[model samples]
Target chain A: MKKITLLTLSFTLSLSLILLTTGCAPDAKSHTGGAESLDSGLPSENIDATSILGAESGIAQAARPDGINPETDVDYSILSTETVYFNYDSFSIRSSERAKLEKIAKWLTDNSGKRLMVSGHTDTRGTLEYNRGLGERRALAIREYLVGLGIAQDRIFTISYGEERPADTGDNENAHSLNRRAMPGVITK
Target chain B: MRSQYDLNSMTKKLYTVLFAASLGALLSSSLFAIEVEVSGTKKIAVQISAFQGADAALAQKIVTEDLRRTLMIDPVVSQGSYSVAASVSGGSLNGKLTDTARGSEVFSRTYSGELRKMAHEFSDDILESLTQVKGFSTSRVAFISGTQGAKELYTMDIDGANIKRLTSDKSISANPSWSADGSSIAYMSYRSGYPDVYVIKLAQGIRTRVAGFPGINSGPVFSPDGQQLALTLSKDGNPEIYTISTSGGSPTRLTRTRGTETSPSWSPDGKQIIFNSDERGSNQLFTIASAGGEPIRITTPGTYSAEPCWSPDGSKIAYSTRTGGGFCVWVYDIATRVAKQVSPGLAEDPSWTCNSRHLVYSNNGSLYLLDTVTKQSARLDNGLTNCTEPAISR
Candidate 1:
């Protein structure tokens, strides 16, 4: 058993903390290196030390949770988060989003006590921070409408991606357009 | 309903009482002969009404109040003196100079006619009282108005007058900035597949791309000297702030932070750059050395604040903030961290005129020039998709 150094302990700790924000894990091996790469503040020796302990103890593996991964009996295909989006920097609702948001309002009302999370996103045209704020703005936009429809505001929480987590990460305008969206997902009921 | 004549009578009585008391006070008074030391640049003057039956001191007071009201709308006249010294004799200001270019010189020029010189003095004094910054009443603003689906750039008076569309190419134009000389403007246009910054010369009628990065290149802010621009570029990877020469050159990286930064606005002195960032968590205004040093967060309570425009006098910074209710334009007085919501609701991207008296912004897809002192507003245009990000040129 290798003793965990302070730097590795903190690095792995924060990696789990960030994972708490966006629970995505494509592959276990890919994330360790990425988390190691993200651990620029920590030295390579410490990262290597942590990587060995991570493989043995499986602490790093559990931190990167994946709801969409090929695991368990839950069919993640048919079940997906509610998709929503915003127009440019505006938070107002357009006529197009009425049908989708209306269904969402009904679903939340019927499924009372369900803890829903709304995440926002924006195009790469603006600043990342701006996109994140826009993402939050988009989520809040839906959250407000849902509340207006009698959904309790406390039942919904928001996190902003600010153009970071893209549904389509292509370089073109079309991809950027699709990436700017807010998709509400349920964490608990 | 009250008659119009009754209102006039009340006004006349108020004026007469002010005149009698003011005249009596001036006549009975004596000057202490205290020569007040001028601090930086005291631009104070009394607006002596050249009107008959108008007492000099009283008229000065009245004009001062009116000027203050105009200031409420314009924020151009900071502080000034209005003289009641009504050329005290023949009662005729026929030959007397009511203002600088001759009290009567400006009637043809403006309603401020005969009041120009004194107003200029008031304006200059305002410049002094505020921060002794450059007086820029003659400045202008250029902004984008969404036409059809495309956004077109338009230039107008600081008070939203004489509006003329500067670009008609039917492209999505964003982030309009004025050169120091106020002759040229640089804005981001998506005429190409990806958005790029373009500069248009007012004198030469030349429109050319300023920056064509591989990815996003936007949020351009012309340097105080009009030599360089600080903008956001994502060509290398994630978004970052880069400065390029106005003449065109490789952009120098200002921030190495992995997170993004954009909406760079220069302080009047050009000593610092206030930009929108989220390194702290959410989008808020932050100030950094123009030379690029440690970033200081300026926003505290607000969750969202963007497009910060500095006053020409450098006393206040106007930015858009999302209160718990909705978005409103907030003015942060530098001397006192007292932030005030100047506009009632739905206003953003404030631009200060040359004089820095009035600010023009977008309110619900319409361009509006807001008088800071008078609290009066005039709509510049209607029938647009949506407009925001107004930039004033000196």
Candidate 2:
């Protein structure tokens, strides 16, 4: 319990540090006066520091184009799952995804006798047919990890929604990164 | 935001050697008079003439060289059955212009006195050979040529004579792709500030806008049956291939993508279309079912390729590839996936005749007729006639 709390605190701190360093980066470099800074690496914050917002704010941008509604923000808990993803115009997962797959296998190990559906999603880009293929590859990658953990491929049905159901709708890259990630769902017994 | 480019490259060289007819009409246009010859028969022997003045021998040599170059551009010699350019010492101009319309008219340039004289004789023999199947001797090339930096569509004989303007507009008019029957020509013009497809009848001078989208509506190819026309349009916010009924109506989208698609070439049967696309991270040739489905790629390598025209027999496909710092014309054999390089210089925008034997294209400042079977070629006219797109009719 203590370890989880500590990790959560550090994750928040890292994000805040990232925002502070990036947000203030442009102002810090104003030494070259009167020039508009062109650095695109800056982080944009939606609400105040003390305010908490929805865990999944990616797709909410369609309704709240102005950004997160801090006062009305509802926090839906997000249970982290380390599902792997594929590369652009490719279906094969890379070596970098091995770590994520191991973590996912451990999750299935801890929660034994549980049913799960490995749903996959791709970011909105490329052709519809191509993206669908991409989603299937992503799902298959996750399924392959579970199968390596001795889980039957048939036991875990996979579904691919190629960029059709994006977790985020904001045009910004931060939202897109959050949406590119894959999450897990434990089916009821 | 979308664009497509395709290239057809032959892995192995085929038909590496070719030659043109040997006759006085073998060349056309210029001083030594080699460039003035056109439309040769089985073999037209071009005679190198000594200049009236200095360096008579050198001038004769110069004319011979230019004669070969001119023969390289003549459609009849460049693309037809077979022709060879061999210089001769002497010959008389016996060809006469029987077609009265050949008088200084754009179409008459195809009937230049010297060219007509040669065309008349060879066309007779060629007509005899043509009658075996049907000769294209009298057939002319309708193309878009420019002068004073402004272009207008024109038609002339394969000899590059009797050039006449078809569309006299202040704006640019180009790519005069003729229909199979030789009765009408479809081309692109910017008279409306945006490129649009316009079809003009030969004898009646009836001009009709076949396609005009809000954006680019150009590169129209008449189906073999002439019932449908395939074209490229950017109306959907990006360039993509589309088709419409020839009689005129709404268009049917053939491709949906982020990549721009243009330069649509229909198959001889009109059941398929080979197009240029960058869908695979680079510009390459791709074919799609005429009704629209998955596209099968044909060309494997090359970053720049475009403007594909299907052979009349549907046995092969001709396209342009960026080579040697300029686009060179090549033909791809569909069944074997083999390509044969035809054009010796920068060439693009290939359009074929009903015979499917020769291809008309443009390089540098003039149009050229490239014979896939013969190595012969010919320059269209002078620099005043900046020919880019050449379409020949049966």
Best by lDDT: 1
For residues A1-189, what per-residue lDDT tens digits would candidate 2 score against the true structure? 445688889999999998888753223222211113212122322112221112212111011112222112211122354655555434445678668667666766776765455555676443322333345445544555557667654455444444545677665656555555444555443
Candidate 2 docking band: incorrect
lDDT of 1 by residue, B190-265 (tens): 5663457888888898987878764457778888888888887655443567788876779887665434467888
What DockQ results for candidate 2? 0.01
| Clash totals for all candidate models | 35, 51
Least accurate 10 contiguous residues by lDDT in model 2 chain B:
B103-112
* Superposed model 2: Cα runs more than 4 Å off: A1-189, B1-124, B127-135, B147-149
- Provide per-model DockQ scores: 0.03, 0.01
Docking class of 1: incorrect
